[model samples]
Target: MGTVFLAHHLSTDPSALSPFALKVVDKSLSFAADADRRARWEISVLSRFRLHDPLHPFLPSLLGSSENADILCWAVPYCPGGDLNVLRHRQNDSVFSPSVIRFYLAEIILALQHLHGLGIVYRDLKPENILIQQSGHVTLTDFDLSRSLTPKKLDPDPLHVACSEPETDSDLSRTFTRFVCPRKKKNVNNQKGLRKAKSARVSPVSRRNPGSFYERSNSFVGTEEYVAPEVVRGDGHEFSVDWWALGVLCYEMLYGKTPFRGKNRKDTFKRILMMQPEFMGKQPNALTDLIGKLLEKDPTRRLGYRRGASEIKEHEFFRGLRWDLLTEVVRPPFLPSKDETELTEEVKKGGIDIRDYFDKLKAPSSPLWSPSLDEQRHNVSLTEF
Candidate 1:
């Protein structure tokens, strides 16, 4: 919820010279309480993966954190390859080939699976938050919007067993391995029947679902375009929401833009509620079919609703994928060039000391205090009509 900078540790010890992306939140802002909470929550979430044994290569582990009266700062490995969105734009057609999409999507699925396994729901899942590693593999970033829900445990069943079985796709060896290049657009009008316009986006929340292992939260929070229909309806949502977003991410990767986006925010919500995803210039395939199933309006009916990722892993789209070998693959779709991997000296200048940057933002006014600018504008009232 604040600015990120390429930074180096301020310590004099050379052993601590590794580069990090430092996120700083100014506690002097009007939304300081909420911002502080989100920052703390993210640190807690990342600590799990950072401290746990068998750390995930597809997620950022917290390097460190510091907070004072004026600012809060935390660091993670800096991704020089930028985000998936940047990579998408670098592609010749601004879209990825099917094989490249599959490669990236598989890693994302694995990342989400690990998060869900830890009882955390990654409420936000857009291309911007999917960071590329120096090795060209993907790592999920920005967990401040994520929610920690109670883990759901279902009674073991035969369908679950069958779905969890990983199949090998020989075709994967022959698939296109080229890496690709990757917004939300919104529209609003005074429609009579429109629901009161909340902010175009929502925040993540923690809630428990009764009589079900899949925790359901009622908080209205997510980027507008990627929000699941159940979430839009204010129906309590659970793990299935991530699957819906994964579908959106997959579609955007293949087409270079998000499906269901409309002229504005309200129009986008309407499309999300009523329209189907448009597949331009391509015939239907297992991938498209899988996207369709994941985007089903009814969360209970979504592709991964029952067995979670295991169900999607068994789909024809991923038929030949060697899930276990994903991390071992030597040739990924794209590798970040040396420039992207190393922090530039320009960024390192003054950025090494994170506290100084945020300290300058603190004001003499009390943290929660707001100046009454309205009082100064007595003669002019724009809303007088």
Candidate 2:
């Protein structure tokens, strides 16, 4: 839908920061309307974050934006450490330790909480979208798939059931029975064996009446592997979907792969609806226990469904964590080197003009095409931060 460039802000003020990531969406593209809508929504969401008194530390701050006859563009601070996926690949086992996961997950939870406070549901929450700032702390990116919905009011007697006894098979079956067809009752007898059977089908259940305090979005948008079961069923989903994705993210960090990924999207969706996460250890631990509750197939029973982030923060996995001192930790799991933060000589010398570059693409095919131009264009495409 767009291209991102490592750009320098040319300004006379000495206080101005120069290096930033410039995202450009060409208005002439075939999906211009959709691209334009996403870009505008992202900018609007970031703008609201910038208005907060202390400004959310973990949410992206919009530097600026502009639109022309042919393109729409916006700028955000560049994260020199790349994204969590890149950082994880750098690890020896392509996975993070328990301590590392806790630190990063804490910051991510805070960011998601802030978005929920503003009535926004962040539909995207995979490792690729969690960028590592220069300080090594995580910040969420890519708000294009996000939507605004009224958050559910906190229940007066919230169910603090995350650490309660695990749900029995009967309980689980009852939670999902309404979504499965009555004719498929025979399949319920073999709940343990359904993981291997590809014939079973669970249809989506539409909500008859949505609550007045909260609005649900039926838009089916999210990365296939990280999507919630509710989303896969096309049932209207709310903020709990993020919690489900968080569980997927946590599982991947510990096990080096997603819990229920199948051979194809169809099989994957089937696994999401039926299969349970397979933990490696012999006994239950705080981390795995937390992931289990967060991955609850019923949105109403998910860990953060009732009281939001507060419930997760109070879990054993995050016990003794000084939430207020996260930013002051001084040492995160990974930090970018000087090379990663330094601007190239070419970038320092005013870099490429984005608008002018797009104009060249529209020019006649005479003497303008060259190997160097092609190389530069490739570089621009690969430099998204």
Candidate 3:
């Protein structure tokens, strides 16, 4: 447990406390957004465990959180280890046991099922987002782009619905606030940022009672790379986007890259719009079949029938899974031996390296330098903190 503590929700005022991790909001503006909105965003996450809690074996449990300045942060149980994506990059990564991979994939399916059940769709499902705990537990993180699997609220406040996509500074700040909230010197730009953020949130979209909500005027947002087809065409999106991302993440995990690789903004969107991704010798037939169904352009036939938890658990790839006996299911099949490195020393020191990596990714650069990440990746290392 964190020496200090806060609420399970990342947005709230619980006194000035430090807990699970000492994350810093990269920008001061986002850190100041209203707490109730943050609470709602995180509720989508915490409520998800009704399908997979301690019994699920893979997902992480919510520990707690605290308020530091205007930001409310969660104390997610620290997974004192590394993520599968990091493991894959190492030369010894080839040593990853097949059984562990199976366990990871199995749990992912269950997670998807649980989210789908509640009508929640996790739009960004990457290997890096899945945490591997010291006890071999796998907790999913970064549901920031996740959409409601059920009916979306009729009139969500645009102020609270921000994300890092759709090219809005507010979205970037919203992500920045929670992802980066534990710095001293980093606050250099914060004073001005907080002013700008406050204006954005307070500038009334309408004069109809400041506290009341009406229809949102903002576009739905997501990282361009992981965004789904229906979303790009302005045709409207749903839980299907999550499945598409899941396919992309799964492909990248096994093949070492996304199936459709484009460096140009128009080209990437065009590729998604018209081209068929080359499976090459990249993955096995079962894997290919699974991705093909997900990447289909048509939202209806795509994703197969949105199945229940039992049906998802019984998919061909997920064979041998005992739905009712989930607790008996083994940990992800391919764990790297729990070396000394597996128990992260950072956690012992009251911090986690997750924010370090994401912080290195940095809050979105100013609108002045705004460029597609693909273009930026060629010229700059995004991971440089």
Best by TM-score: 2
Relative to the unseen true structure, what is the Cα RMSD of model 2? 9.3
- Assess every candidate by TM-score: 0.78, 0.80, 0.59
| Clash totals, every prediction | 14, 0, 21
Error of 2 at 296 (Å): 0.5
lDDT of 1 at 24: 70
lDDT for each of the candidates?
Answer: 0.71, 0.74, 0.46
Task: Quote model 2's TM-score.
Answer: 0.80
Q: Give the runs in model 1 whose Cα sits over 4 Å from its true position.
A: 10-17, 151-211, 345-356, 359-385
Cα lDDT tens digits, model 2, 248-315, are 99999998999989998888888898889999862799999999999998886789886677678889
Best by lDDT: 2
Point out the higher-scoring one by lDDT: 1 or 3.
Answer: 1
Scanning candidate 1 in windows of ten residues, the lowest lDDT window is: 176-185
lDDT of 2 at 342: 73
lDDT (0-100) at residue 275 of candidate 2?
Answer: 86
Query: How far does residue 317 in candidate 2 sit from its true spot (Å)?
Result: 0.4
- Estimate, for each residue in 1-385, the C-alpha lDDT of model 3 and write its tens digit: 0111111112341221222322223223333343335454764476455344343445444554445433444545545445767766763533333345456666676666556555556666777778766555566765555665333243333334332212121111111111111222121111111111111222222222111111111234565566566555544455566678776766666667676667765566666666676776544565577778767766544553333233334446656644444434455443446452232333222322333433444456534222243233221111111
**Residue-level error in angstroms, candidate 1, position 75:** 1.2
